[model samples]
Target: MNKVILIGRLTKDPELNFAAGSGTAVTRFSLAVTRPFKKDETDFINCIAFGKTGETIAQYLTKGRQLAVTGSIRTGSYDAKDGTKRYTTDVVVDSFEFIGSGNNGGAGRDQNSYNNGYGSSNTGSDYSNSSSNFGGMNFEEDMTPVDDGDMPF
Candidate 1:
């Protein structure tokens, strides 16, 4: 029940780091989600992803690129250098997808034409491929059809 789903744009490039003791990869970023009914307001949410997901996000995602994420809310507190207690709320990203038409502020392209063989290397495009790449979730290909005869509703 502690789930959160959000579609938004990256406020900046994801910062990838490693755990001090375990050396596990961790990436942190902020998402700017627009308010549903407000035109000029946005919510800045902090998000974190671990392992290969974090590495992929840091490698492919950039600032201002639209993204969709499913995760859970997590809260933590730490003592600051100034002796003040600092609190943080973050979305521990379980899955994410790249949005837009691959033309994310012209950051998806390089001087060369090929974009790591993903898709068109045009700098004008924000995403390269047609499929929405996702992380942290394994999609099964052999899904059985549900029967409506056993419906409880």
Candidate 2:
């Protein structure tokens, strides 16, 4: 029930790290999301991706690139050196999709073709010139001839 979907640009390149004990990949970045009604206003949201999802994000995405992120909001609190309590809120990314064409070495290729799960070995050729079929229906196969006289309008 705590799902969040955001379409925004990365403020900077994602930082990728590994958990010391588990060696799990962790990627962190900030997203600049503009307000729908207020053009001049924007929000910088912190986001984190774990495991293979994190690795893919760090590998393909960069600053100024648009992304569609699906995740959940997580909030936490910590004590600072000044004895002040600081609260933090961030999106824990479950999945993400590339939004637009960029200089990420995958131009003119399908971005969504890359698998987001672990052990995905997608190459550049794997996404090149890919096409999507809407609703699993091929328009050419579903067409039916209609007569002009059948129209009531």
- Provide the TM-score for each candidate, comma-separated: 0.68, 0.72
- Model 2 alpha-carbon drift over 4 Å, by segment: 103-110, 113-153
Q: Model 1 residue 23 lDDT? A: 94
In candidate 1, stretches whose alpha carbon ends up further than 4 angstroms from where it belongs are: 102-153
Clash tally, candidates in order: 6, 0
Report the number of the highest-lDDT candidate. Answer: 2
Spell out the clash pairs found in candidate 1: 102-125, 102-126, 102-127, 103-125, 103-126, 104-126
What TM-score does model 2 achieve against the real structure?
Answer: 0.72
Instruction: Please provide, for model 1 over 31-106, each residue's C-alpha lDDT reduced to its tens digit, 9 standing for 90 to 100.
Output: 8876676746778999998876677678877876666677789999999999999999999876665655233533
User: Candidate 2 on 1-153: residue-level lDDT in tens?
Assistant: 887767677888899999999999999999887667675677899999988778878877777776667778999999999999999999998666564554354343434644344222333322323233222333235434223232221
